[model samples]
Target: MANENGEGEDIPVAANVLGTIGTILWCIQLVPQIWYNWRRKKTEGLPASMMLLWATCAVPLGIYLVLQNVNIPLQIQPQIFGALSYVTWGQILYYDHGYSRLKAIVVVLAASAISGGLEALFILTLRIPYRKGTTWPALFFGIIAAIMLTLGLIPPYFEIRKRHGRVIGINWFFLAIDTFGALFSLFSLAAQKSFDILGGVNYILVALLEFGIYGCHTVWRIRNRKLLREAKKSGRSVDELLEERELERQRQRELESSNGERFTGIDYDEEKSRPSTEAHSVDGGFVQEPAGWHRT
Candidate 1:
């Protein structure tokens, strides 16, 4: 990413242009998901860990890009990404984790301060080595950023792979924009005077992971379309059917976890915590249970 001149070197026009566009897209890529979370008042499908991981990665990434003296857009992308990631993470804590507004705001502010301080320290420390013509520190930060970025996209796969599950919290618009941003970043690297292998690999890995997410999105769409048709014929709204489906899955899980006991809208331990050595039937009958069933 550094030129022989190390500063004020002319970058290719195409690289500059593509980097600009990619930067713009990346800046807004998370906006849709943030807005969706605000409107939905929850963050079910979107894991807070993913956003936190991204924010964590951005610190080192920003340090690396700035130290490497990459093009202006690439230099600033991590900073903006980190800020928005904190916002999204704040929303998740507030809505999904039941944190109070004040608590969530405090947490986000603390995180931002810590990351900003860390990035500053890293950049300052790495600049000394960079000025000494030692590039390993920059490379180290780049490698760390790449690994974090790759790991950040894994949590959502666990959600989407569940039975009859759909991509619930993440917005497709956000994903589409992100994919375009990745492609543009890759193209910018291709157009650059020096190909940054770390940067190129980072972008390529994200784009490929995003392709799998898009495929997951496609499967959800197909299943949802079928359910929509069924909803019409069954005189039930899609929401109702989806809710019923989720309840059914929850019941099945509870049933399996309780060793053939039925779910009755209460916690398993609470339901079985009675001192009597009998399980109460729905019809108010007392059925004998196995010994020590109440303890577990």
Candidate 2:
């Protein structure tokens, strides 16, 4: 039961305990991302491919959620978590490149209009045919979904990375929360006396994937730090490291030119000092005393 706060006071203790645990995990997961993004102000080296893959995974899970329709206390299956996941993704986008409130309102209106148009074309005009269980439709939409998700993740990734030159400020706490949330989800599923339903399995899988993502990201960040250090030692900056290497070629050219000049100077002096055979004969040509040359 909630205390004097008057917020959700009378729920069962199990659900509350599960929710609390899940929430802690969610915070763990989210805090790192948010902290890195905010403090380091960078998202560079974060693979857009990874995020795209994640969103791809999310799509199938969302479909599964719809297909299984598992119910739990507090609607604790994928429905609540799934929707929350989308919201979190949206927040990521906003955190990176959010618009002003008024501008966001305009964008929302515009998006609504576009969606309305599409709905009209499909539902009202009946121009689009509805097909079930077709491979072609699945392939077409699958590619489209992949492209759209990739596109959505691209901007913020670039924006944050470009801004901070690294993914420093990202929140790690959020990741922890999410990881724990998955465990709680697994527990909750086990709590479901019915083993026949797919909800628990689905949540377990989701949690596993989320944990994998966090693990990979952590390793990636560590490796990236080493890479950056190496880059700096080699006299390169994050954005222009390659360019700096190209500039080093100019240094090489200058060094080669200087060396060539020294060698050429020595060769020229040697050639000039070579005595001509005619100098021994001294015929017809007035033999001037060999010009006294003094090495300076």
Candidate 3:
């Protein structure tokens, strides 16, 4: 348990430094995502689910770091910086993509809560159990983190290799950030000779997901782009094609309007032509009693 400084199991200055490096890597991860959103002015390809889960993990970790008497520097290194990254992502989604305020807020809040819960649970169990000479919390957290990390990438996997070249909910920029962030974390881990359960595995697995799946999507996107260019070069009428798309949309709207109107069951002509049946019936099938006398 002795750290290099002979500090008995105390977090080392070196670990703090590497934690700073990890924070920097996290900030860097936001860049690609932000840039993509800015360029596209949209969060179209971004996966809300992944961001939601990851942000959830970060917020709790942030809270845990704060509670641990870990210096602000260390806490800020990941917790503050990491939370900011999620916020930045959300902002891009809102301002760039014009997502409604409610939707953006939901994503932000969910991410914060999940991150805070996980971080708190991990640290509290670590500290409290260690004081009582128990490591079960650590084991449980490890298993949970592993499961989450593995499942987190499945959506992206389907997005990439589904035989139709669909990226599904995965964003290419987000994937790139995740991959490089993992690479950076691996490097940071190697440098500081420290391995934390969540950080290291998340880094590696995310990298693999990006390279294996998202990378394929990028290739397909490029291929499609090339085909589009060739079509343009051959004067295959790309604008006209897009125009036809707009026209089709209009037609669909028209059809929907017509269908809706037909189903509404309001007929002015019938209303105008219909007699007052109640009044006609009350007029008495020709005053039957008097009519009987007249007939007789």
The per-prediction CA RMSD against the true structure, in angstroms, equals: 11.6, 11.9, 12.2
Q: Tens digits of per-residue lDDT for model 1 on 197-265? A: 776887888899889888877777786798889999999977799889989999999879786544544
Q: Candidate 2's residue-wise lDDT over 1-296, tens digit each?
A: 00001133344556547755664453335445545654654444444343434434334333322222223322232223333333334344444445554563464445444533543343322212322333343234334433443343344445444533333333556545655675775564454433313334444555555455455556655756765687789787654764565689999999999999999999999878875332322455555344454224
Best by TM-score: 1
Task: State candidate 2's TM-score.
Answer: 0.39
Q: Give the TM-scores of the predictions, in the order they appear.
A: 0.77, 0.39, 0.55
> In terms of lDDT, which candidate is stronger, 1 or 3?
1
Question: Model 3, stretches more than 4 Å misplaced?
Answer: 1-19, 38-41, 59-74, 81-99, 110-126, 161-163, 166-174, 191-200, 221-228, 231-296
Candidate 2 or 3, higher lDDT?
Answer: 3
C-alpha displacement of 76 in model 1, angstroms?
A: 2.5
What are the clashing pairs of model 1? none
TM-score of 3: 0.55
Candidate 2 wrong stretches, greater than 4 Å? 1-20, 23-101, 105-170, 221-296
**What's the lDDT for candidate 1?**
0.82
